[model samples]
Target chain A: MRPGRRIAGWVFIAPALIVIGVFFLLPVLLAVGLSLTDFDIYALASLRNLQFVGLDNYLAVLRMGLFWRALGNTLYFVVVGVPLSIGAALGAALLVHSRLARCRGFFRVALFTPVVTNLIAVAVIWKYLFQTRYGIVNFVLGRFGVHPVDWLGDPHMAMPTIILFALWKNFGYAMIIVLAGLQAIPDELYEAARLDGASAWRQLRHITLPLLGPTLMTVGLLTMVGYFQLFAEPYVMTEGGPLQSTLSVLYLMYNQGFDWWNLGLASAIAFVLFVFTLAATGLLVRAGRRKGWV
Target chain B: MNRARAAAWTVNGLLAVLALVTLFPLLWMLSVSLMPQGSASTFPPPLLPAHPTLANYRTLFVAADLGRYLLNSLIVSGGITLGALVCNLLAGYAFAKLRFAGRDRVFGLLLAALVIPSQVAMMPLFLLVRELHIVDSYAGVILPALASIFGIYLVRQYARAIPDEMLEAARIDGAGELRIFLRVVLPLLKPIILTLTILTFLTAWNDFMWPLIVLTGNHHFTLPIALASLAREHNPDVEMLMAGSVVTVVPVLLLFLLLQRYYIQGLLLGSVKR
Candidate 1:
């Protein structure tokens, strides 16, 4: 590249860089700063009430039982949701990858269709499907002598319902990624395993999982991170639920930020979520390194 | 011919059942949408409607103001696609081919920024929008989305594959950078641009979270927001909600079905490790 051309390159990129830096980076810094303060609706009208309380907002979030409830709900989503989603994805991929599978392309598309469908649209469908009285789900359950359950209205079932919808919508993504991983695995490994009299289960445990380590880590971490940002499902399906059972931290943050206009407190909540996500991501990476997975 | 073969078929057959279960809700949503107003709530739960009608769609267009929401979605999604393409293309080109001070460092910083959830910035961003007095306006919903980090990353990877010798030759011919970019680089990069265009539009169109929070009014509400609100208010109107679901979901479904290859390829590209 010529010297004059280099200047043009910088010029081409400068506007976007400036826009991102000012609008995105600056606000994030301000949010971190604001999280340390007690900026509320009062502070919104006037800056006089905006006094820096030095971790007071964070402490308040810690003390709030709602935050704990939201955290527990989010963790429940992560721990259970991630595994089930990954398992479903893996199961689907295995089927698609199998030699016995015919019309593989059609099944792949059918399974993946849900991944790209509008979340709000499908969550609405799930909400209605899980409706307590006259719902298809309960109606089906009644055939087996099980009574109708208030899925979204019951504290026990609300989060689980959200998790199920999430799995249905999301697992296809992991399936595609894992299918790619499965394809990348050398056929020779499986052939060698078969020659050694290895069963399918043993081959999967020793050869498939071991060889799929890096992709598995990436899949796990990505799934965990994605699941933690749980908002639209609960917001649409349960509205954070009958007992706030489906309320993830991000949903609570949005309710606080937009509904109550507690910008400072919401920013604190967002930072706490960021901290939790970062810690989880960091732990995954550490574990990956320790196990030589990456 | 053998028990093992039958067992394998059984496993696949069970998976086929599971696949149908997964897709049943979406198909049922459409089925209900086509049903008459109260036909959706029945005891036997008809697989296909007894008497299908376009009345629900007519209702969506006339009574529910979904026509306006559809227009808004198209405009917002179109504007985002146009703006994101230019910004991502230029910046991605710069990242891939350009030389400037702190180029690697700036790129590294951007990569690091990707890890921080956008929600961390959401609170401060809302405040900034409020201060600008642009909250609830179209600009609030569109501006921040115009330049996505992921879009840039996608374009950078695509642009990096362009032959550097061609750009050098164009520069030697006394063509300006912008002209060369427009005439030379862009034509060569057409396929990826199309892919990114579809992706950015679909993402912005189907986006729920930020738009839901920022655009609160009925007028400003996008398709997803309008559908979500309708779901809340008219829960009993299963036909109406299903109609709304079809309205929100059908366009993207068509787009995906038509361009499944690009969409799927782009999906794998943006996410999975090569």
Candidate 2:
């Protein structure tokens, strides 16, 4: 290329490169450095107050009881939420894909409304719906002679309630993706199955499931990673309360970094969360490959 | 209904019922937002108000100062959209078309960087924002979001399909690179530009965590942050909270409804690798 054109190319790319390099890439590298120090409110006061602690932050995070509890809580959310979300999405996708279904566009919009709405706002609506004494949920259950359950107030129930909320808010996204996958399946395969005297259930098992393996794996991975970052729901709905049952690893990191100004510890927590997400994604990919799905 | 028809109708009926269940909370939020104060907390929570009114919405704007937060959200989201559009489009176009040394290598590096989640950089980014003295300012939120890897990738993917021969023709006619980009390239790229705009705007508008951390004062709080803090302060006022929820949710919902084809196209474009 000519010098003028080469300079133009450089100019075109320079602004984005500068911003990403400074704000994103630089901070990631500096976060590693920050994680090695004993940075806190004292360090915030004076740069001189900071002390390089050489993996002490990671060690302390691993040793802390709250860290483990937060990890467990986050794991519970991912383990329970991802499957339930994928199940709901798959069901919705199949129903929408069914020949019998009517007003497909309307159903798609209605289901997808939750995904686009502001999370904090919908979380507030859910907070009231799950209220203890006068909540609509319990009020409806009362008609069936069932007692009221403290949905968000009970330690045991808080995580479950949040899980239900997560499933509701997110399934639409997965459904859309799965729907695309469903549409890509060849009609000849289903025709061949029908000729072989296969029932609908058998068709779904033998043909649809196998065909959808890659899509479902992607859906599962995305949902699991998203669920692992469970902060906003508990933050808005329960405040990580009711004996801290709703506290997630990301939430713990937020509290440590933003609330307490323990930047080093929070950086360590963020790395741990990253590692968890990476390993989970790797495992799912490996499992999918072993089954000859990907 | 005949047997097969009955079965199909049964499936449709089941789908309708499920859709209703899915929509109930949002519909109830709208219904309750118009109810008299404290009426939503009543037993068997009224699905619709007997005497509907706009008192809660009025309270939100007048008493709770939600209008200011809405304005703040608009400013922050709008600024990010415009800035991110320029940066991502330029960089993405350059990546797709412009020949330079190490271009593919740099693009590969950017793609690899996508694996490092944004939250990992939050602590240091916060300190960096603090040092730049942009903490609690719109700049702090908007500046950091001006160049996302996903946004750049989306534009690059779209820009790659633009025929290089057209650009070469323009250049042979003595059209400078900037002129060709502005007149010829941008017109052809209009569809993807609209998709990128809507995607960036919605993401910026609905973003919570970073804005929550950066903006310290109420005057600067976005709608999500304001609504979150309001839920904490006015925990018992169900009608008011629903009004707040409605206000926060309606605009984006309307946007999605109107431009759903483009939105869904963009979503599928991002997700499915062809």
Candidate 3:
């Protein structure tokens, strides 16, 4: 390339590159450094109080029972939420993509509305809807002779409630993606199958599922990565609470870093969360690759 | 033919039920927002307000300072959208069309870095913002979000389809790179631009954690942050909170309704094309 062209190239990219480098890349490196130091409120007051503690924060986090609880809660959310979310998305997508479906456009838009709404706002709305005494959900259940269940107030129920809220909020996104994948499958394959006395269920099992493997893997990875960052739901709905049953690792990090000014500990938690997300997604990618689906 | 009709009815019936379930909360939010204060707190949680009133909305705007928060949201979301568009478009076009040393390597590095969650950088980024003395300000919220890797990726994916010969023709006509970009490339990138605008605006408007941390003062709080803080207060007002949610959500919902075609197209292009 000519020098002028090369110079122009750099000029075009320089602004964005500089911003990303300074704000994002620099902070990530600094976070790793920050995690190693005892940078609490005292450090916030003066750099003189900061101590170079070197993995002590990570060790402390490992030994903390609350951290373990937070991890377990996050894992439970991911384990249950990811599959259910993907299933909902797939179900919605298949319904919308069905040849017999009517008002596909309206159903698609209605389902997707939650994805675009503010999570904090919706979580607050959900918190009210699941109120123990006056909630419509329990009121409806009462008609079936079932007693009112404490949805958000009960420890065992809070996490499940949050997961349900997340599924409602997010399924539309993957639904849209999966719908696109579904559309790409040729109708001729199904037509041929029908001619051979194949049922819709059999066609789906044999052809649709296999063809959608790559798309499913992609959706799974994206959904899992997103599910791992479970902060806003619990933050708004439960406040990590009713015995801290819904506290996520990210929520824990927020409390430590901002609320308590345990910046070092928070940074360590952040790194641990990042590592878990990376490892989990990495394993998914490898599995997809081995199956030749990615 | 009867069997086919039955299948159609079954599928459509199921879709209707799912749609209703999906949209109920938002519909409920709008419903309860119009209810008389404290009426929604009763048993069975009235589906529609007894007397649909704007009392809650009036209270929110007049007493709760929601209008101020709305303005803050507009400023922050608008600023980030405009700035991010310019930056991402320029860089994304350059990566796809322009040749420079280490260009591929740099782009590869960015793609690899995508897996690192943004929260990991929040602590130090907060410190950095404090150091710059922009803490508790709109600049702190807008600056960090000015460019995103995903935005760049989206633009590059769309811009790659711009024919190379067109750019070369413009270059051969004595047009500068900047002029060619402004005159030639940008018009072609309109669809993706719309997609990015809607995506960025929605993300910025709905964003909670970062702005909540950065904008420490109530005066600078965005709609989401303001609503969250209000909801967290003791003896919360249900109708008023729902009203606040309606105010926070309606603009983006309207935007999505209007331009959903572009938004969905962009979603597919960004995720599936790769």
Q: lDDT of each structure? A: 0.86, 0.90, 0.93
Q: Which digits, one per residue and each the tens of the lDDT, describe model 2 over residues B1-274? A: 6887987887788789878877999999999999999887777678899999999999899998989988999999999999999999999998998888889999999999987888999999999999999999999999999988888888889899999999999988888778888998899888888888888889999999999999988889999999999888845588888898888899888888877877777787877532
Listed per model in order, the count of residue pairs whose N, CA or C atoms clash below 3 Å is 0, 0, 0
Best by DockQ: 3
Residue A273 local lDDT, model 1? 89
Evaluation by lDDT, superior candidate among 2 and 3: 3
Q: What digit string (tens of lDDT, one per residue) describes model 1 on residues B137-239?
A: 7888888887877877888888898888998888789898889889998898787887898898889988988888788678888899898888877445888
Candidate 2 segments exceeding 4 Å error: none
Model 1 spans with C-alpha error above 4 angstroms: A1-3, B234-236, B272-274
Clashing pairs in 3: none
DockQ of 3: 0.85
Q: Write the per-residue lDDT of candidate 1 for residues A1-294, one digit (tens) a residue.
A: 557766886788886787688678888888889898888889888999889989988999999999999999999999899989989988888888888887788889889988888999999999878878757898899999998899888899888888898999999988988898899999999999999999989999998888778777888888999999999998888788878898999999998988888888999999898899889889888999987887
* Residue-by-residue lDDT tens digits, candidate 2, A1-294: 446787787788889999999999999999999999999999999999999999999999999999999999999999999999999999999988998899998898888778998999989988888888878899989889999999999999999999999988999999999999999999999999999999999999999999999899888877887788889999999899889898999999999999999999999999999998999889988999998876
Q: Check candidate 2 and list the clashing pairs.
A: none
Q: For residues A109-143, could you state the per-residue lDDT of candidate 3 as single tens digits?
A: 98888999999999999998888898899999999
True contacts kept of each: 0.64, 0.77, 0.84
* Candidates by lDDT, descending order: 3, 2, 1
lDDT of 1 at B1: 92
Listed models, DockQ each: 0.68, 0.79, 0.85
